[model samples]
Target: MFKRLAKCIAFANIKGGTGKTTTCINIAGYLAKSGNKVLVVDFDPQANATSGLGIDGTTIEYSMYDAFLNQCQGYDGIPITKIVLETSVENIHLVPSSLNLGVASMLLQGTRDKTGILKRIIEPVKSFYDYILIDVPSDTGLFMLNSLRAAEQIVIPLDPSIFSLEALEYLKTYCRDIEEMSDHVINQITVVLNRAIISNSTQNSSGKPSPSEEIESRLKELPDPVFVVPQSLLIYRSQQEGLPISHYATNTGKIGKAYEAIATHLSGNSNVVTIPEREAEYAS
Candidate 1:
């Protein structure tokens, strides 16, 4: 099982409300469900990953922050049994985040090797999981720099909105800076367009093209995003109940199928490279 493990991946973007947390939790869960031992490191101080996976964020005594502060050398202080918490889905574990992570970020900023702190901390546990998925905060700060440094691949979740497109450009700029500043080489930073509702809303009122068509046209103008996660209310309901969409809406049809497709794509055997664009015509 350990032999099949590959590089850790971080999911990040400079924009909030992009479904970054949702995709992180779902991808980790799906990977674990597919028989890989998955570890999700929740780097967001808001603890969305922790709560999303059914772990009460406030109760976690040892978080990623503690691991960073001690340089992961004092991990022994945490009981072995308590180091990882299982999610509602089998095979998935979470390293909960604490509010103190904000302080940890401040401390990281004071260090010379700011980009490598997370990498150094995760190194000891690298061999234990088949895949490690990091859910980073929305801001492009030292925390994100550490996340990128720790990862070989990055997945950016983008909401299909004008602001999100602008944010993607900003994130790309940040990625360039990180590459210039650190020795880390994130070779696979793929983008995933999320909340892709196929609205038939277009500019021309007379037989206007669909919203999905508009989105598709936009996608055609650039290099493809890795995938487009359709907007499904199932996700919202599941999140409200602290459950992964796959687990909560397992039999709900299209949404469940979409998540399954995402899982399949992540595992490297699917034709997920081409993303279908949505038709969304925004009034400028």
Candidate 2:
């Protein structure tokens, strides 16, 4: 039997447009490119990660929602192996999410182990991957809790916004509370600063640090390693093509380099790039 050694990590943030799905997809792409097998679990109800990997939503016969719905309804849940699907990227697989995912949460309303349901479903597939990245939603509900309980590592992706800062503080306290409630320690935490406006020529009319700069400064105060992903048009273009920045961004650029560093660091390779204490801009 293969050993269950995959590092289950969650790319999470409590606000939309914070690059939660983007960070997760790029990280998964980079990891798979490095010969590390990866499994991306689209735990979010929106299922952006599923389609972002080029998996057609209409073709999915089984998904993470089915697994939870079956288990909650006392039916024989489908094995994760059966639900796992090949993605556009080699060495990477995905447990796609569907519209019914929100319905599955309703079924867990009164379950004995509501939050542990996802953990149970993922346990069986842990041996097949080196990294299992869960793309969770922006909330403190069952979905977020389930992923948090199941993950050994957490990556908080944030953009330049006041709401993002609030989310970060909230998550810090929320993770602590969960740790106290359950014995599961969040052994590792990484903060990824996304959508940073890194422009040297552009001048802020307000004469104050931009939101991205302010958030960067605040994150520096934390002990966790922080990575910066600059705002680029290529990110949106790549998403439109349902491909990761690493895969679509074949050119040498700031965005790709930053993500590569993150994948390397997460793989325990090196203390590579971090949020440097300097003003840099990603040319659009």
Compare the candidates by lDDT and give the number of the best one. Answer: 2
Mark the regions of model 2 whose C-alpha exceeds 4 Å error after superposition: 1-4, 205-208, 277-284
Q: List model 1 lDDT by residue over 14-59, tens digit each.
A: 8897888999887776677678888888989898988988888767
Model 1 clash tally, residue pairs: 6
Instruction: Point out the worst 10-residue segment of candidate 2 by lDDT.
Output: 275-284
TM-score of 2: 0.92
- TM-score for each predicted model, relative to the true structure: 0.85, 0.92
Each prediction's whole-model lDDT (CA): 0.73, 0.84
Error of 2 at 239 (Å): 1.4
What residue pairs clash in candidate 1, if any at all?
Answer: 211-278, 211-279, 211-280, 212-278, 212-279, 213-279
